[model samples]
Target: MRIIPREEWGARHGDGRYWTTLPASEVWLHHSVTVAPDTVPPWTDDFEAIRTIERIGAQRFGSVYGFPYTFGITPAGLIFEGHHIAKTGAHTYGHNTIGRAICLVGNYETDEPTELQLDAVAWLLRHGQAQGWWREARLDGGHRDLTATACPGRHAYAAIPRINARATQPIGGGGASPSTGGAQRRYLQEESTMQLQPGKHGQYRSIPDGATRVIVGCPHGQMSARIIWHGPGYPSTHDMDTRWPDFDWVAKDAVHNTIHRLRPWRVPIPEKATGFALYWDYPPVEGHYDDYTGEVSFEF
Candidate 1:
């Protein structure tokens, strides 16, 4: 992974005060919504573009908080160091302490990031883990996953699973892949009988002993789904409604509906765990939006 240091990018340091020195356990991906200043198509080189972004961020967030992220990635796939990882950023509220934020260069709601850019993200993650920067980091999610904003836009967010999978691959091909025997395949194909009542907050069910993955889906688009499990230390939760807006109504033909496919390898679930739970919440409505129905599939 090619990492461009702050010195190389001509970035200034913060005031020397840091929140803490703990390594990050989560990485949050985001997209810079700002466009270039004055050009025919509003395009700028990566260096100047990131510089502009930093200056703007300083002006906006520097007064109260430091730069909002630990790193920024350019369109050309070069990673730039922003705030030092030791300092807590204002990137994601309620999670700045534990999460490292990496903002991609451009808005991706309408535009798709290049393949090189996605590959760079994966490579950076792998590099961080190898360097012990975030050796305990296993969860890689978008900024919107923890917040209500449409950051790290839909197209960019869609690439997170693939990026995470690539990052977790063995360095020189030694790690074993998950087994997919006929029994396991049969478990995945088994239809879900669990039905979520409207306005229900949480539900729990016991999973098969050797289940490796949990697939959760909510067809009603307007609602949000979260899958939580009791593990060794504390309960861990993965938010499902990151890419789509909370209350936006979706047509039946919409390209992507709301779904959360929890791969235990990516989002770690306790090995000794027996049961898991599903928690969902939505905006209050006076009339009917859509009857909320969720399904959970466990793969053994």
Candidate 2:
């Protein structure tokens, strides 16, 4: 959990060191997507990507004194200090005062994070909580969730829980981050199968109170099964809000059969979420489910 100071990293704007209060309320996750993930990984390249980030920060928001995030994590699992928890950081725009941001190096959309990277990020979070940088060390969500940009990238965004879970290490052993809104251990635990029909109003399954992962499994495999997410409002199956054009009853396996060889289609969802529903829909696409049924599986 050692963080390389800016001085050690040869930061150009390390002069104006400042401080804030302890135990930040929110932890914002981000990814340095600008760097080609394979452009020589950090294990040997030192902090070149970090330097690029600092250069970009200097160019975009000249007023900001130094790097935006409180910390920068390399793919090699190195933690570099930008701004300390008490110090005001330029990340997360208006939320800087209360939020501590950690930017993971690489574009996770195309690059799957390495185990070392994940473990390092988790260690940082856990260390923050254990050291009293933040009381609960709440993970407010990724930068994309708070703003318009896809900052953290899809793969990095999906690993938030794993980060939280790994950061759940015992304080004596290492560090800790904010637990996922009090969920000390958030993992993919399967739930019972839920059956949903097309365009049914007020017809949704009741998931457990904590956040969950939704997987649409099509035992039928790659047929005419398509479904979309339904929030607390439970939008109709055909609503444009569900991002569907026709009847919304498609299954998951059917959708991924082409690329994934019929792996269960995983639906992107919010962290620590509640009030959700699955809207079944069907489109003009070819093929049909073998069993004529698409099942929804819940995991947490």
Candidate 3:
């Protein structure tokens, strides 16, 4: 029942953000799905993982109020404190004042969280409630529960029932309803990159055949001119600055780690349109590169 203190992991001081009393109301779960290869990595130990998230969160939120989530856990069952329970989190917006975010280490979309990781999460929740860190906090749900995101990924999210069922409280739900909106999901290669020589005629690549809607995830905060996607390769090929009307530009749990996170840009293909590619209409600038080559993908 021991949570590694943030100071031990070198967490920065908060700017007196959402400081709350003990036994907070709700509990939210998440997967770090961290972007930016430079920052996210398999650290030597679980504590290092917290340090890394701290560094990224620091830059994201600001050195003063950087650390986003309230806690972090690795696959090895190690629980590290982020902001103390009383310290309300910057984890989920709107709901920030209400709940604390506990994040699982690996990306759950494709990677499976180990049993040890789940065990640690369940244990932490029970411990928190018993210690008056939260108000009988329940494993409310994954990050996707409170927002629009593929966070806590399918695999980890799918495992929620298993964790809650084993917890002190009786479980009732099995996470969000399983729905893919009818169309089968299709994916572009991961971390694929394209060079945009400013004025050069940008680049184009077709999506999978039946992909009616594509949820494209691009590195956040860089759509200005760098790594911008200008709709389909139709009429004018559009510009990167403005979003295509049809495409639903949904920003995931970003704003904190904009540089490192890949925000989702959901694009719906026109019915009559024959072909499509995430048209990257480069702007007229000197020289800029989108080296997030392997950092691109879509699930439609």
166-197: candidate 2 lDDT, tens digit per residue: 76766433322112211332322223445433
Name the regions of candidate 1 deviating beyond 4 angstroms: 13-17, 36-44, 63-66, 136-139, 171-300
- Model 2 steric clash total: 25
For candidate 2, the TM-score is: 0.53
* lDDT: worst 10-residue window of model 3: 176-185
Q: Which regions in candidate 3 have their CA more than 4 angstroms from the true location?
A: 13-16, 35-43, 169-300
Count clashing residue pairs in model 3. Answer: 7
RMSD of each: 21.1, 19.3, 16.6
Which prediction has the highest lDDT against the true structure?
2
For residue 250, model 2's alpha carbon misses the true position, in angstroms, by 71
Tens-digit lDDT string for candidate 1 (206-226): 665566765554433345566
Residue 215 miss distance in model 2 (angstroms) = 46
